[model samples]
Target chain A: MKKHNYSAGPCILPQEVFDKSAQAILNFNDSGLSILEISHRSKDFVAVMDEARSLALELLGLEDKGYKALFLAGGASLEFLMVPYNLMKEGGKAAYLDSGTWASGAIKEAKFFGETVVVASSKEENYNNIPKGYSVPADADYFHCTSNNTIFGTQMKEFPSLDMPIVCDMSSDIFSRVLDFSKFDIIYAGAQKNMGPAGTTLVIVKEEILGKSGRIIPSILDYEKHIKAESMYNTPAVFPVYASLLTLQWLKKLGGVAAVEKLNNAKAELLYNEIDRNPLFKGAAAVEDRSNMNATFLLNDAAHTETFDTMWKAAGISGIPGHRSVGGYRASMYNAMPIESVQVLVDVMKALEKAI
Target chain B: MKKHNYSAGPCILPQEVFDKSAQAILNFNDSGLSILEISHRSKDFVAVMDEARSLALELLGLEDKGYKALFLAGGASLEFLMVPYNLMKEGGKAAYLDSGTWASGAIKEAKFFGETVVVASSKEENYNNIPKGYSVPADADYFHCTSNNTIFGTQMKEFPSLDMPIVCDMSSDIFSRVLDFSKFDIIYAGAQKNMGPAGTTLVIVKEEILGKSGRIIPSILDYEKHIKAESMYNTPAVFPVYASLLTLQWLKKLGGVAAVEKLNNAKAELLYNEIDRNPLFKGAAAVEDRSNMNATFLLNDAAHTETFDTMWKAAGISGIPGHRSVGGYRASMYNAMPIESVQVLVDVMKALEKAI
Candidate 1:
């Protein structure tokens, strides 16, 4: 049976991505050697790394804009530490918006560097909505924000226009929507969600924003060193980068991020509309702030839980169990998730309403 | 035609591992979801992480000991920074043995934390051999060494005994040979060589040696945090970890590291004997310090380079061109390389001699 995987991360990718990646694993680029076993410095693999970095920037429409893309090894969690290590100066202050779990985690790491200020937070509301009326301190070295909250199912619709460098963690919603990507000086995402797999992280940094942090930085944690080496400072995550390239290629074929945004918006509308229209269900997040990538909803009455769970399982819908903190169902509609899958989920919800 | 792969690190893995890994990329463990598309928290993948971790300790003969194995990212380069962060005390000193490029890289990162003493260095000899008759500072926080030098083709036949902790970077030679295994306090290897691919790194650290650094460690670089999280503190390199599990299974099935060590020694002897007998070729590293995993050699006369190179290419030998720093040929014989492949390369060397 075909499985509709809505896994929050390390999540669904294009079927074509899987097929090509499998072929590469068996015999990469007709070299008769598994991609798993080739030297990363080999001409063929270097081409892969180069293309992956180029495609990541090109997809974001940040090409030729003084931005360099790096496919790094550690996930966004490492970025939490690298961001402060690279951007925060000696005795510097960084401003951040507390939006969700990941945002809070980034905040925790930032505090280790120097003074960190929370510009605004929706934590009082269990992060049900993106906080507004936040003011960034003019003296901050940088203003950081999480573009989307996967756990809370909320996404910032508008980013603050700050004179300081702007950084965004777009881990779950990087290529799923169209945005003025150049507005942010540094944008990073773990590849598992919309891009490819779990091993690599995509970091697109405007070169101008680096080297300002006077604090001595370790070579591995320094953005400038990675950019200078073209993300080959050390051995990179080869298979993940190649898989990400395949995914980026798939996105380009689908008419880039703009076209995918439309498909994604449609998928979100289909699922969100069902959650709102159905008497049995209520969306968990604030209606206006709901994430287009992940739609979190809960049954209006607790008695219908078992029925809905069984129905989704029988329909071959997988990984929709909401995060433990949210206590609901989260249908993650990343770029690769088909609207047909969303429809199947909605049909299951509809069946639950009738059966109840 | 079958090709012999001798690329150092991100080198050859078993053919069965390739087949199994490719199949998992399509559908993992009959779960009807690509391994790349599944959550790390899922029961299936959690099982994979557990088994890989357990197998690592089991194969190292350290399961019952107070040690933990973590599959981390950022390769051994990150660990260079991490080792000092987690072990070196505030304003304290750490001792290092400079054997090759990677060992020097580690020493560079160690210098960032506190006083780093190079207890012994073979750099003056162009890293042609491991240095001997030098002593580590008794009061240093810990002592560090590389078990094998891929570029220089030298392996440490002995380790220093000290009251302080001992850390080994076994990136190129882990699982290729048998060692006491419990002599070191910490061991790390980039999985690309004998384990799996380039994405994940294997870290085996004794439980008792952590949290003494007195330095505030970032969560990502903190080994204790990773160990406490059971190697899932963040999204691990899913595909690499899974592939590593496959390789470990292969090693265990083939009677584990001890059995593979005998085969590796035989392979090294066959190639080294030819290098010694062939009047045209000369081994790069000192005879007593030659590595079993990577054997670096050169043509006695530079004029024979083109002919030998052409002959090896014709014989379907790949990735044996030495690192640019050491301008010669390096034949890397990782665990998965067949003895038959070594015979093929030996035949090519003999052919080169006859043609010249």
Candidate 2:
């Protein structure tokens, strides 16, 4: 069957990006050595590393500043602990906003190393909206937030008004918009969503925020260690990093983040409008809190569930199944998801509504 | 230049493996979705995951065993920490033979989670040989060893004389030899070396060794967590895992570990013979302790370095530069390397000898 991928993460990628990436993996940058077969230190691989780092900074509008861009291993989950281990000082505290599963996971990892003050949480409201009236600690090490909740379809929408360092798990929505990165001291994301693949982690940190933690971090878990080593702290996730670099090149050639962000919103609105207009379907999260990347919804009651599922699958759309945790459907509209896929999904929704 | 890749890890791959892997990255298994874009939970992805897991067990000869195979995101460097995080009881002791860099790294991570006993250490001799005369403590939770040192070119060569549960980092030399799996409690390797790429880590662990560590492990760092979650506790390193699986398939079709081991022996022998015969080349590691995967040697005089380097590069050989920490040359002959590459290097050495 012709398939359109709507998987939440490990999600869709551009055809050009994948083609270029595959070629590189086989024989990187025409170096006659597969990206998979070269030293991370080779001049070719180093260029990949440098270009990837520079692009990340460029995407975030931090190219002129001295912020170091790193592609490290162990994903953002490792960064949860590493962030605290590097920046959380002895007797220091970090402010956290518990917006979703990933946010809570970050809280748990941070607690392992230092004290955390959860300034706001949407758990009481089932994470349908970003919490309001968060009390940021004036003396806190940093304020942490999950920029977009993939499961619940919520985004911070705007930067948290903070006087302290703001760290974010921008795992799902990193390049989806033109983010004002200066407001955040550090931003980390797994590459599965908007970046490339699932092995390397993209970290952008202000150089001045490091070296305060009293804890002795294991070398692999240290941020400065990675920055100093230029993410070749060890032989890094070479293929993933290389793939991510190709994707970045694709992003640049497609006229950068601003160009994609416009298309992304159009795709999101297409599916979201269908949900609002269709009688049988209702958006799962609050309209104001809807995620531009992942659209979550449920068939009103159980009667039309099987029908909608069958129609979408027959239309060659996949991963629109809602997370069992949320009990409905989620259409992950990452950058590579063409607007046509969303329109087809919208058509499926209308057909299901008419059938009902 | 048509480069010959001998880059210790992130080493060589079969041309066919790269071809298929590259195609899958663009469009996976004919699903019309890039491999990186698919949900790990999708049936197609699950099938890829299952096949890769099965192949790992088959390669290690663990089909009918009390074992579970997992493909994890963190490289073995992270596994160095995770092994103890999941297996070590609070204050419980583990025994480790400090063979080289990896073993020492693992030792550092294990000590953070529990008490660690260094059974023996070769730091006195810079880890040129596996330490002898180590007594395993019955009270020890597990015994750890690195199967081979990529830097020093030393391997365990035989199962360590131990009675406790055994764990090993076979990152550099896995699949280069035929070995009994009955002795190990857990075995892991970063995929960069013999398996495939650098993003994925392969683990074979007895299920019973889990649930012993009473601490709460961060979800991603927990091996037990990954095992329970079926290696998809998070978005996996899809591209590298698929490539590793393809490489394993290639190995299986080439007649499994035994046939590959014979070819590996011939490659190592050709280079080692040249080193022994040529007056210009001096091996850094003990002869008995040499690794079949990476051969470390120094030119007779530093002045001869550029001559041999130019000769090798003209012949399309690359990445034989030794690690800066131990400068000379290192010809890593991982499984993907054609023996002709080694023969060419051997011929280069002979020509250098005659020229001198």
Candidate 1's residue-wise lDDT over B80-100, tens digit each?
999999999999999999999
* Residue-level error in angstroms, candidate 1, position B304: 1.2
Q: Could you give me the TM-score of model 2 versus the true structure?
A: 0.95
* Chain A only: TM-score per candidate: 0.99, 0.97
Docking tier of model 2: it is medium
- Candidate 2: give the clashing pairs: A11-B37, A322-A328, A322-A329, B10-B192
Q: What's the true lDDT of residue A138 in model 2? A: 93
What overall lDDT, based on C-alpha atoms, would model 1 receive against the true structure?
0.93
The per-residue C-alpha lDDT of model 2 at residue B259 equals: 97
TM-score of chain B of each: 0.99, 0.97
Please give the TM-score for the first chain of candidate 2: 0.97
Candidate 1 lDDT tens digits, A228-316: 99899999999999999999999999999999999999999999999999999999999989999989999889888888888999999
The B-chain TM-score of model 1 reads 0.99
Regions of candidate 2 where Cα sits further than 4 Å from its true position: A1-3, A353-356, B136-139
Candidate 2 lDDT over A243-315, as tens digits, reads: 7887888888888899999999899888888889887888989888899998899888787777878898899
For model 2, what is the alpha-carbon lDDT of residue B302? Answer: 94
TM-score of each: 0.99, 0.95
Q: Which ten residues in a row have the lowest lDDT in candidate 2 chain B?
A: B155-164
